[model samples]
Target: MIRIVIVDDEVFVRAGFSALLSLADDIEVVGQAGDGAEALSVVRQTVPDVVLMDVNMAPRNGLEATLQIVKLPEAPRVLIMTSASPDNTAWQAFATGAHGFMHKAATPAQIIGAIRMVAVGGTATTPEVMKRLIDENNLRNPRHVAQARSRIDLLSGRHRDIILLVGRGYPNARIARELSMSENTVKSYVSRALEKLGVDNRTQAALLVRDSGLLDETLANESRVL
Candidate 1:
């Protein structure tokens, strides 16, 4: 079973998550806390496998809690749960070593999925959060355009095409349809592109391409061809 601890300032929020998580056969609610200090105490005692952390709490906020939790000898994987926007807070959580970010508005299944994914050493970022990262990177880094072009030049033509689609947020099914390939083939291409780019997943691959400045080059090339 996956052991979990819920940390949110509001009593209802903590109780609600605890109750929902308890209903999942594979998840056990080992502890719940209404503030960062309480969370730290509970975590040190229970050492749950995953922590559903809230970003805004009295005394110590979620970001501070996450930093503290990751420092523990047997630190549990953290999945930050908050209503805050990805633009303002998500990257901070990521930088603090959170394995995933989930909005409080997410469904119970999504919450559970995020916990499971983090528990097993995988990262999960909500699509909205991913989009915010992309948008912010674009706005802040004009140098990325040139960098993306260089990275794209390092890849085969097919791989470059796949990376371009991923940067634009096309799902595998859409990418397959656009390229006239099977979904499995598209998945294979994505996997290969990730390996070639030295990235662990699509989001990182997309970020790399964006930060490298390839998005502009790819678009310009396509425009010229048209």
Candidate 2:
């Protein structure tokens, strides 16, 4: 089962999500919190696989909470939900190492689907939000790309190879096979690489790798291996 923690400032919202999620046999609601601080405590206590959190809350907001959460050892995947405009918060969510973002107005199916996606190392952003994120913020602009490349440069060659493969959407077992290493070693290498890259998860690392354009260069260099 995919364990999940629900975090929202509103009691009704939390209760509603809990009730809705109870229907999914593959998902279990392990905990709930009414604010960012409480969410952190619940997350640490529950050790859930995924966390569905609202972006707005009193005192400490979701972005602040997410930053702290991802720093925890073996942190849970965070799917940030918002009722406000993505323009106001989506970029910050991505920066905080969120695995997914969904509008609060999304359908029940979309909500459940997003939770499932993030639980398994996938991103769950809608095309619209992503478009805004890129188009509005220039995340792929030359300056940002250069910054991404600079961070990626901090990785050793071996870690760079693994992160490039990770950007290609390879699972850990596949990465191990490609690199001729054991799965445990691949996991270790990936974890270390992500840490060095300052990303909380593989999805964020993948984004960084993509933005850095190293994956394209790696693919182009593959001909030399023949």
Candidate 3:
């Protein structure tokens, strides 16, 4: 049997999930909790094969708990369930070594299948969430690289050079020193680059720069110009 625990801040949600699991003869709801701390205690006691974790619990949210839970001896695979689209939170869940991510709106079949998959040490994720993770981690899908290259091409040469440094993991101060510009100027350039690229943070911009293969192209062009 695939032993399971359901963890959610809402009593109704925990109860409802447990009820849903009861319908699957091969799965067993071993315990339930209303918060992260309670979830931890129950997990220690039950040592379920899989944990159905709600992502937004209070005092100790699911992500925080998952981080701790994975350290224990023979930790259960945690499957995070969020109320909305995964976005950056999906990346965080994977960082916590979560085995799966799915919106709370997942159908009963999907939820059951996810739990079963996780129980057997498999990742359970939807296509959208998986794609987000691939992009977030800067995995170079060919199409993604093409898109990133086009966006980076729209940047001025100076901006392209700076973002290349950013992709090489340069800090603002280091970039300033390397380019013989003030730190404040580097910061402004970074902010503007991010704006033009339509990304929220330096990390995403760095990912774009790396994916775009822009560094080699820029260097070759500059060499030719020289």
Candidate 4:
């Protein structure tokens, strides 16, 4: 079973998540905390497989708490929950070692799925937050050579080519046509790439490729660069 901890300042929010997670056969709510300090204490004691953390809270904020938690010897993976707004502060959360981020308005199933994915060592990012991160990176560092090198090392030459095409927003059918492979083969490659990258979904994988500077290299070279 995937052991979990729910952390939120509001009593109802914590109870709701705990209740929902308790119903999942594969998941167990090991503990709950209403603040960052309590969250740290609970996680250290329980060593749960995953943590559902609220970003806004009194005392130590979620980002700082996440950094502390991730440094634990056998740390639980953290999924930051935030409201939907430009002021939500997701990028900082991600940079601080959050394995995933989800809007508070997400359905219970989505919340559960995000926790499960993170427990299995996968990263998750919403599409809008991902685009913002990519755009920010592009603006701050126009030359992404170092980032490109890291992404290339993550895959075989053929797989890297496939990832670049996917990052360019190509549909699987179009990717298959361009690469002279069947659609099923294209899907297989994308799935494998997602697994290798430790991301929960294709959109996150594509965003990773883009943020790693591989996409920039491909554009500059006028070919599938990495």
| Model 1 ranges off by over 4 Å | 140-226
Better of 1 and 2 by lDDT: 2
Best candidate (score: lDDT): 2
Ranking by TM-score: 2, 4, 1, 3
Displacement of residue 85 (Cα, Å) in model 1 is 3.1
User: What alpha-carbon RMSD in Å does predicted model 3 have with respect to the real structure?
Assistant: 14.4
Residues 1-226, candidate 3: write the lDDT tens digits: 9999899988888889988989999999999988898999999999988889999988899999998887788788889999977878886786676768898888899999888766654467777776776566555678987888899887887787788887654667778889999988988888899899887555456556767877556667889999
Write down the TM-score of every candidate. Answer: 0.65, 0.81, 0.61, 0.67
Superposition TM-score, candidate 1 onto the true structure: 0.65
Off by over 4 Å in 4: 84-88, 143-211, 215-226
Ranking by lDDT: 2, 3, 1, 4
Q: What local distance difference test score does each model get?
A: 0.80, 0.86, 0.81, 0.77
Instruction: Give residue 198's error in model 2 in angstroms.
Output: 4.3
Candidate with top TM-score is 2
Clashing pairs in 1: 144-212, 144-213, 145-213, 147-212, 148-212, 148-213, 148-214
Clashes of each: 7, 0, 0, 0
lDDT measured at residue 1 in model 2 versus the true structure, 0 to 100: 95
Residue-level lDDT of model 4, residues 120-213, one tens digit each, is 5556656776677667767645456456457546888667778778666565777888989998898898888867776655545565676677
Winner by TM-score between candidate 4 and candidate 3? 4
Report the lDDT tens digits of candidate 2 across residue range 1-226: 9999999999899999999999889999999998899999999999999999998898899999999998799799999999998885876787788888899888889899888878866678777887775475444579887998999999887898898888765768778888899989989999999899887788789778878877767777886785
Alpha-carbon deviation at 37 in model 2, angstroms: 1.1
